[model samples]
Target: MIGLIKNEFMKLLLRKKVLISSIVLGVLCILLCLLISVAYKFTTKEAQIESQQYIIEVFEEQLEEAETEEEKNLAQANLDEAKASLEIIKNTPSEDDPNWRINVEETINILKEQLNGLPNDSGEKEEIRKNLLEYQELLNKDIRPMSEMSPKGINMLGYLIAFLGSLFTAIIVIIISSDTVSSECTPPTLKMLLTRPVKRGKVLASKFITAFATSCIVIIGIEIIASVIMGLIFGFGDPAYPMVAGTDYKITTVNAMIGKEAIAVFNSSYLSTIFSVLLKSLLLQVLYIMAATSFFLMISTLVKSSSASIAISIVLLVSINILKVIPYVKPVLPFLFMTYGNTTTVITGEIKISTLSSLPSPIFVVLIFLAWTIIPYIISHLNFTKKDILV
Candidate 1:
């Protein structure tokens, strides 16, 4: 059994298609980095200038609406602070400006002072305090910021893996899984395997195990390469940077939520060790990808045509994802495999959840995933072992 599994793994590694897939994944990771850099270059400076101007306008309106002495005092103070921040934004000419760091530090200090003036017992006030303190730390340390307002290194890796990386892994799995049985059938390898003393069920199980192992390697390899390349360019950053996660379990960097940190403290640990946390958080997403892979493998085994299986898998996955957005259909489809595929969101306890009463527990999501994984493989096993192979 061990030798059979090893042979199956070797067959995958030796394939030119697998080599091509790896190259494609690498190139895509490089492109993700370039795209992020370009976006940062175009948006950050303009956003700073425009955002300060917007804040100034907003404070002026609030001052006009103030109806009491305390309200007026708070409004006037905020308005004065906004005007000062706008001046700072204008004085710092470029990202390279030495004054830029000084101006940001000063602005953060002002925010910290403002945080203390708020009602101490208010939940909203405490949220504001954390945001101020967080930005104060970021600016004082001169941490490189990205579009996600996270430290550049961790943000680049985490965002890439969470969004594009998940899709890329799914594509690779589909490619490999769709080819697993059909490729063998096309070349009469299935018949040769059947002639051996091994039962057909064992042969099928070997293929499934090999595909699962290959998928694990593909996911871990892509993330490692992306992390190393981006870290080299952007600097690995302080592992202790802070972040706030929303109710949906999605993360928001301290820099991103500069003025509003109402999120619970569950993300405090994640903030302190973002790089490691990101990798660990992504394991939930990886399991989601694996569930999809198992489905495709089952399709390939039962269908016996690589093209048909690949096409069906793509369409089904896409359709299910799109269906998740429909209010009417989404709630009714909890049992659907795709419903549990977003384990990241489920585990995060998002505000907008799939469950009717509230967000489903992570354990519940895991059980659904287990059902998805076990049922497909069982069906595939039964189908492959009983079906007559055409030579």
Candidate 2:
């Protein structure tokens, strides 16, 4: 058994394809990072347009720059007289308080007038829009949507990362799942391996371990590298930016909602950010590939050609989408192998999730998926050890 594991390890290590796959994953991570950065820029621009909220400094300057001496005097008198009044009006304006409404209208008109005065060049507008859209996205900070001046979420970026990551990962899991077993079963080497002094179970175990390790090294490596490059380029601070989708903005941010000290309380380290992303993504791919490794390792024992395992795994993955929509099967939700996969966005701390909210705790969710691997894996091992390979 020990000798078999060693041989399998050497085989996996020597494969050039593994090395190439790792390299490709790294390059793809860099590309993913660039895409995320672009998304940040687009989100910021759209948020600025929809919010239409001007900073106090800009409003203050406008107050001093009204056209004539009388305009300036009126503005100065209002600034002194209505400091509290305007702010109250800003916060809760009555329809009768036309003064509050007029002030806001004047400011917006001035801003628009300035914007219209700029050249109609597309390049210039794009540049200005991009500049106005600057926002900060931190690694592990709470994110809340700042749209509509209320509480909601803008979980799109984190979810988008998880979704896209989950997608590619699911595809890779399919490819490797069947390959682990079928490749061994169909090859000339399969017979020799089984007939060796070693027990059949060890050989099966080796397949699972090798493939699991390969997948971890590949998928985790890709996400980590991509996140680091992207995080650095976009810079980290706070995920206070709003994502404007269609006509609404979704925001997530740490509740500096309490007091002056809350600002410092919300800060998260770079490693925390990386770790959150890593764990979330790792949790996703691990459970997915683990399920694949187990089922296929069993299939490897049954099939004559590695190609069949590959085909079967791909078919199974595609079938998962169809199964998710079935009403009758929804009751079996937690037990489904596909159910354990996406733990990434759940880990981002960006959403307004309660700690106790998931159908099961994240810990419970992981344990269930793990059973998919362990239960089948042990059975395959026992079958491999006890059964004759001559068939």
RMSD after Cα superposition, model 2 = 15.4
Q: Per-candidate TM vs. native?
A: 0.69, 0.57
Model 2 spans with C-alpha error above 4 angstroms:
1-3, 13-28, 45-47, 50-161, 236-288, 345-358
Q: After superposition, how far is residue 209 of candidate 1 from its true place, in Å?
A: 2.1
Model 1 ranges with Cα > 4 A deviation = 43-151, 246-272, 332-357, 388-391
Q: What is the Cα-based lDDT of residue 214 in candidate 1?
A: 85
What is the TM-score (0 to 1) of candidate 1? 0.69
Please give the TM-score that candidate 2 achieves against the real structure. 0.57
- In order, what is each prediction's RMSD in angstroms? 8.4, 15.4
